[model samples]
Target chain A: MVTIKDVAKAANVSVTVVSKTLNGYSDVNEDTRRKVLKVAEELKYTPNMLAKNLKQKVTKSIALIFSNFERANGKDGVLFQIMSGIYAAAVDFKYEVVIYTRSLSEQQNISYWKFCKDHKIAGAVVTGLKTTDPYFQEIVNSDFPCVVLDTDLASEHTGSVSTDNVGAAKVAVEFLISKNHRKIGMINGHEFAVVSRQRLEGYKAALSEQDIDFDPTIVVNSDYSEESAYELADSYLQEHRDVTAIFFASDLMAIGFMNRCREIGVRIPEDISILGFDDIVLSSYTTPKLSTVRQNFHKLAYQACEQVIHILEKEEKGRHIMMPFKIVDRETIKEL
Target chain B: MVTIKDVAKAANVSVTVVSKTLNGYSDVNEDTRRKVLKVAEELKYTPNMLAKNLKQKVTKSIALIFSNFERANGKDGVLFQIMSGIYAAAVDFKYEVVIYTRSLSEQQNISYWKFCKDHKIAGAVVTGLKTTDPYFQEIVNSDFPCVVLDTDLASEHTGSVSTDNVGAAKVAVEFLISKNHRKIGMINGHEFAVVSRQRLEGYKAALSEQDIDFDPTIVVNSDYSEESAYELADSYLQEHRDVTAIFFASDLMAIGFMNRCREIGVRIPEDISILGFDDIVLSSYTTPKLSTVRQNFHKLAYQACEQVIHILEKEEKGRHIMMPFKIVDRETIKEL
Candidate 1:
């Protein structure tokens, strides 16, 4: 319960002097600052950040607004990895992180801008936001400082960070083609997701370049869920028996497809080769392992934090930042 | 920016009336309160929570202090599920949740009490703390409202929530015993963790109940890491050739043991049965799946938040809460 007044009295200084010294103002004498800090430590006086933020009209805090964060459970560890990266960067920058989970439907009643204002958030890093969401439009049109993940939205104060989905997908498909598999199919994620569309485009580009006609009938879409992919796998396999290989938009979907293939006695790589994207941890543990494009979610989240902080500090303009991706060869793919 | 003064002026009311109305003070007349709210909405005014907290001397905010949260990456989604539960309860209770990641070493420089004070945190729910940690002692001795996860420390102001590890472990081991396995070994997690100790006790209790002598030499310890378990598995298997079954303290360790078993040409269930604790998402996807005990991390975290909030609101005395656990049967175990 020790206050600034107590620290001032103990240090034989005025409250203003104590405040300036504690707030790290250069106007305070070095000796006086040292004495004030010593007294404050002895008194165990902790400054109230709420009052300080109110008085200074600034807060050294950011909100990590995650849409559909509940999906993190029973799924891959992508969101958790992103959270770790965000926290690491927040620690380095000495900023506090507040987490807010919002479903897509919640935007009708809540505004992200007002949430930031009420919480005194200096900036925000949002993920899992679709372009069609009401909050996405609000963020795109507003001047509030924000960094989005895996989205193409950018504005005067809104930036984005994501892996080069198109290029990575193309490289993966090309690798499959190099293995003498010309009849390649695709299992894409939700059509609403930007990365899904980008990956699909890459699939087509790789097919056209290799003189393999792009077959729309062989392409399937899942809701980025393992169960959905599992359900789609049986029918997709039955209809496309000539497809020599298949590219999956995510590791989770690939895992689901593999599970179904196992049940139906379809041997991986022997019957059909499989390639996956977003090399989640499970990719390494699957029965035949998995060949995947590894996107560093940690780096993506770290850069998103840095981008928002940079925008808030006026050190950089908001813009899209594409992180690097790597294609990892494992047991799932086979040469003809 | 819209202010209280603007709302008051537009509503033809005084600033004090506007403030009182917005703050939900019952002293304001109903019609006046409605008028103030309507004007505030029209003006697009969002109340500054920082300033309101400073004036009210109470904050509707809680901190989720996670020790070694970085371990969440590339691992199971236990932490993420806990986070989801905490957020869900926070929303229901109308409280804001702020995340704080602290390593054991960080306590020397930062005190939890000071952190809660500075951030105006009404209470806190901390997870992944060891009994030997400096912060554990602080929580035990301090009067600050807190809820610790998976620890026995509880005080007049500090509560705790965890699964009934001893009972759950005993049940799992007893099931293995029922399968006619006499020579059973165990791979426990870090010795510093309370759950590890509790589960070890449970393992011993099950042995005693079944009239089987406990063998300390066969019980090895890992750091609850897959790599550590994988390394330990080779030596343990080589030395304890007579062991018919093994119980693991965590699913991650179990998976590691399974991986090592696969590499060393040791067939699971046929050669030796395996049981694990903490049925994480990976348990369902492993080669033979994993028969394990399931602790509801989501429920534990939700109850921890509720406990802390209850203590803060003077609705309940801080005490330890033991949640139920389940035994999940998969493909990892078999009759000897």
Candidate 2:
């Protein structure tokens, strides 16, 4: 097998220069870097990353920690989108990704820091963690470089990435209000999730801005499950028949609501217009094509990976990144 | 940080015994293993995987290579299911998963073997490779331990895992035939894909067995793309009006055909019935829920990972594993 030494000698460069160039360090001049790469390719030199990482005492890899990932299995593609985005960004940065599913970690009784240490992971991008989770506090307090998704928790080492959930929800609700719907009911996800609470704040803000009285009775919470949302919709719709529109915390919840409406002989847009958050794939194929606040999950995850990489490689202090969101109008909403 | 030596000393065992016990080797006696694990846990010993992997000359990690994975991004969650299965299996075996998206490899001009060598990947589970792909032949002939998905290519070091595509396709076509449909057209995926050829053979065998004259003109091919299938459906439907039903090679293609049928004012199962393969998530949500053959994608990937690990750890000869499939009857098919 060809070694880096052979490539360095063939390229008339020092071993350090060859290593730096191959590892994408910017100090190496462009011409020298190209020459070293050409020599390495010609000699078929495959660097042993395990050995390099051992010598450095840190692997050029990031851990993607998704808490309770299996819960989303086939129900929602949001986690998959985030994973793809992380992979794409990791590829761009020439870093490997090691997934640490939090459920597995909990089952093994391994903490996030321990998993990172055992794997020699340089940084991590964590998602699907509720603020009340034990791991959430541990991650916030740990000095390990990481980017937390969906919650604004930044420190010297920890970064954050999420769509402006509050603003996005406010915009979604204002869109329904703009359609002359005065009585709008909101179905939210669990309050334990920071995003859910933020979205609720946005919902209330939108009503306040429009001079519409916010009714606490009309706002209900579900555990982000379709069945839970379906059950809530069944009861909420009966008691809140005067409401002209409803805003769902997630597309999956909206789908459940739609299913319940179908079963209960309620017509969408004719009976009540519905708007949802998270423009998941199923939203487009629904009966009336759900109008939603589209959170760019891919972009959010991509930026999280980028942020963690930056914190690791550049020794930069972590910062919060708010990605853009859009209001997607489909057939579900009506110009009441 | 507590090291293996500290744990071994505390447990009154040799370092090698402690290492073997902690690594889950059965050679260590149960009492020693239990004592070593307890000591290690009590001491908060986190093994440095980088150094361990380097010393062993191979990482306890499997590479999951997905060729052109981005093509399926959000359209179908089959790849995600496969990934989830792989991860679940990897965690069960205490092995780490490193994803290698082939698109990045192609752009960087890295061969599969080179990647394995660089990362010291113990084994790999490869999917979505065409028979004619340059990497496919390389993987088939390579000495590295691996398991290929959806293709039968077994050597001393290479295993194969896939659903029984031919048998499943035969059953699907037979179901349509049993419904008293005499004239059936077929829409296949790209000819280069092995599954497409297998399914086509099954379609022909079903026809031959039932004494239905095989008309080659009625069979058409698309590039396993929704738009391509949609365009093909337009002309195919116009040309073959006598066909009472059509068999699609994949659910995605079936969806495309369904979309075109809706546009041309052709009612499914009334004007023409449809049978699809690969029960993707969208199939259940289509206008008149798709009836199709369901390949257990998650199980396929899980078995593939298990096979690769078995080949690497136990020095087992690679074998072809055929998983079962099911015919999911929904609303797409109608009795003649």
Candidate with best lDDT = 1
Q: List the residue pairs that clash in candidate 1.
A: none
| Real contacts retained, model 2 | 0.73
C-alpha RMSD by candidate, in order? 1.7, 3.2
Worst 10 residues of 1 chain B by lDDT: B66-75
Q: Write the per-residue lDDT of candidate 2 for residues B192-301, one digit (tens) a residue.
A: 89889989998998999999999998889887777788888888988899999999998888888888898899999789999988898888777788999999888899
Q: Which stretches of candidate 1 lie over 4 Å from their true place?
A: none
Candidate 2 per-residue C-alpha lDDT over A1-336 given as tens digits, one digit per residue, 9 for 90 to 100: 677889888999899999999888999999999999989878988787777777878778899887654786765789889988998899999998988777744835877677678778889999888777768878887889999999999899999999999999998899999999999999999978898999999999999999999999999888777788888777788898899999999989998888889889999989999999999888877777889989888889999999999999998998899989999999999887
Docking class of 2: medium
What's model 2's lDDT at B189? 89
Every model's TM-score: 0.97, 0.93
lDDT of 1 at B19: 88
